[model samples]
Target: MIEIDNISKHYVVDGVAIPAISGISLRVEAGEVFGIIGVSGAGKSTLVRTLNLLERPDSGRIRVDGSDITTLSKDQLLRYRRKTGMIFQHFNLISAKTVGENIRFPLKLAGEYTRAEMDRRVDELLDLVELGGHRDKYPAQLSGGQKQRVGIARALANHPKLLLCDEATSALDPQTTQSILSLLLDINRRFGLTIVLITHEMDVIRRICDRVAVLDRGVLVEEGVVADVLLHPQHEITRALVQESCPSATTGQRLGLSGPLFRLTFLGAVTYQPILQRISAALDVGFNIVEGVVGRIKETPYGQITVQALGDAADPARIAAAFGEHAVRCEALPS
Candidate 1:
């Protein structure tokens, strides 16, 4: 597990110190996919760099599996760093090198392997990333997704337990993004790798992350399970991110509902149950679903549906009470 304890970082510009991140503290459990999400200038990049000590913090400690990495000696840091790996938004491959050579870069830098051993490791990584056929191909010869696969392969060359992704899929289109994200998930499942990914997009967080931390203007605003945060966003920044992913999940006058509109959040078995129909029938009322977005968060099913109650069902408390019987949560959404 990785524990960030109140770490803070600042930069000096023209003799003035500007804070890049402040009192940021969070945890990434071992073998779990943890995501840090924020918009531009939110200091997400600074925070991720600090995890690997690429950008050192001005205060506080970083503990990886109970070891304080904040104050390691140069040699200790070098040995320590070999335990972690990093991926980037751009596929940072050496342009002149072939795919196999790019994957061999890190092992060669370690200088602990003979030529034959390095070759074996390179071939292993290419196969692991399912890029065996691209061993001799240069970066220019591959598509964006293929290039990223090679980058991921290179990152695993050191056999690192932890992988840090810095806006790793931002450079790809939606379809390619899904493919890369799926590959990451497959790697995590196959090897039990701990992944710490930072992105501004919530959809990326929703898709692969187990837990997520929300950052806004360098501060940790909120943190929770992916399902909880995405289904019921608490912070304004989080809500905005949700809006981008599912615009229909929004609550307001724009929905064009004349009756009382309530936003209903359903989970697990309740999501598939006929609670809404049964309740409306029992109350002798009718409801029109204004809008909704239903999806699975990792494994759990979640839905945020907007419905307008007509006649007797318009009683907010009664409507809520009826759904309570079936464990379906309903809230009177502000318009």
Candidate 2:
């Protein structure tokens, strides 16, 4: 596990102090995918960099597995850094080096692996990222997604326990983005590696993150399980981010319905069940679905539906109780 304890950082320029991140504290559990999201100038990049001490915080402590990493000596820091790996948004591969050479770079730096051992590890990583055939190709010869796959292979070359992704998919198209996210998810599940990624894309978090922390202008505004934060956002920044990904999830006012409207949330098996139909019939009330979105957050299936009740007999309390019985949540919305 990783613990960030009230860390803050600032920079001085032209004799003026500008805050980058202030008193941000959070934890990342072992073997889980955690995401940090924010807009530009929100200090997301600065926060993620603090995990590996690339950007040191001016205050507070960073602990990994109960040991404070902030005060490590230079030699100790080097040894500690070997256990962590980071990938960049732009594929930071050497244009002159072959894919296999790039993957072997970290092992060569460690000075512990022999030539044969390094070769074997490189081959294994190539297969892991599905880049076996591209081993002999240079970075300039590969496509954007392929280059990222190579970068991922290189990052995993040293068998790091924690993987850091800094907007790893922002440079790819939507289709390529999905593929890269799938590969990352597969890696996380297969090896139980802890992943910490920073991105501006809500869809990226919705697809792969188990939990998320929202950052705005250098402070942590909200943090929770991916499903909770996405479905019912409490912060304005979070709602706007979710709105960009799925507008229907954020607002139901576009329908302009006359009757009472409600936003219903279904989770897991409840998403597949006909709970709304049964409740409408049993309560002698009719419902009209104004807008709906169904998808999965990581592995859990979820759905949000904006519905309008036909009769004045629809009691909000009773409706909530009925849905609650089936592990669903019913929330009343404005007309």
Candidate 3:
């Protein structure tokens, strides 16, 4: 488990002090996959780095498993870091070393095993990452996904309790990214490793994160369960991310349509309900459905549909009111 209290960070650019993160607090439970999402300059990278002391906060306390990591000495911090592993967008592997050598390098540096033990551990790590046959290949000889597998194996060489993933799948293609995410899920299930991931892609968060926190301009904008936040986002930034990730979104402005533009987000069992038909039958509202999308976030099915209410007899407000608390959203366009 990890707890971050009132954390803030500032950096000097040229001659002026620039704030990267300000008074952000978060708690990540053990064995939970936590994601931090934001656009550029949102301080997502800075926030994740602080989890492992890669970026020291100017003012705040960081606790991991009830231990205040901010108070650790240099040597103590090094020892603590062994339990917290990290992977990056770039593979960050030793170009000169083979895959097997790269995985074994960590144990060699720690001086914790004999030659036989190192060989056994390297093979086991390779097998765990499904790269056993390519262990002898160099980084240059591997594909981008293979290189990332090597990175994952190297990160896990120490049997870390927590894994920090900094845009880990940003460099891979969509198919490769999915494969890597699947491997991470397996790792979480098998090893019970707590993971903190930072990414700009909402799809990445939806695929694996148990919970997510939205950040913008170094501030915590929103945080909650993936399903709750995805279904009912409170912040504009969060909504923008979700909307951008929608597969059926249209171009240009959405608010200037002839009819009222509405975004209907379906949550829980409400997704299975035929509320749209019920509303149409009960209320004098004609629905012109535009964008309809369905996807899963953390295995929970979520859907959003954009619709336009047409004709002079339509009453959008009355239609939204029909749902009460069931399912409803209506935004009147400019006439």
Tens-place lDDT digits, model 3, residues 185-274: 899999999999999999998899999999999999999998878766899999899878764444327434565666677766677788
After superposition on all C-alphas, the RMSD of every candidate to the true structure, in Å, is 1.4, 1.2, 2.9
Ranking by lDDT: 2, 1, 3
TM-score of 2: 0.97
Tens digits of per-residue lDDT for model 2, 95-178: 889999999988999999999999999999999989889889999999999999999998898888999999999999999999
Judge candidate 1 against the unseen true structure and give its global Cα lDDT, from 0 to 1. 0.90
Separately for all candidates shown, the number of backbone clashes (residues 3 or more apart, or on different chains) is 0, 0, 0
Worst 10 residues of 1 by lDDT: 249-258
Error of 3 at 305 (Å): 0.8
Q: Which runs of model 1 end up more than 4 angstroms from their true locations?
A: 249-252
Kindly indicate the candidate among 2 and 3 with the higher TM-score. Answer: 2
Order candidates by TM-score, high to low.
2, 1, 3
- The local lDDT score (0 to 100) that residue 196 gets in candidate 3 is 93
Candidate 2 Cα errors over 4 Å, as ranges? 249-254
* lDDT measured at residue 80 in model 2 versus the true structure, 0 to 100: 81
Residue-level lDDT tens digits of model 1 in 7-124? 9999999999999999998988999999999999999999999988999999999999898998889998887788788998899999999999999998998999999999999999
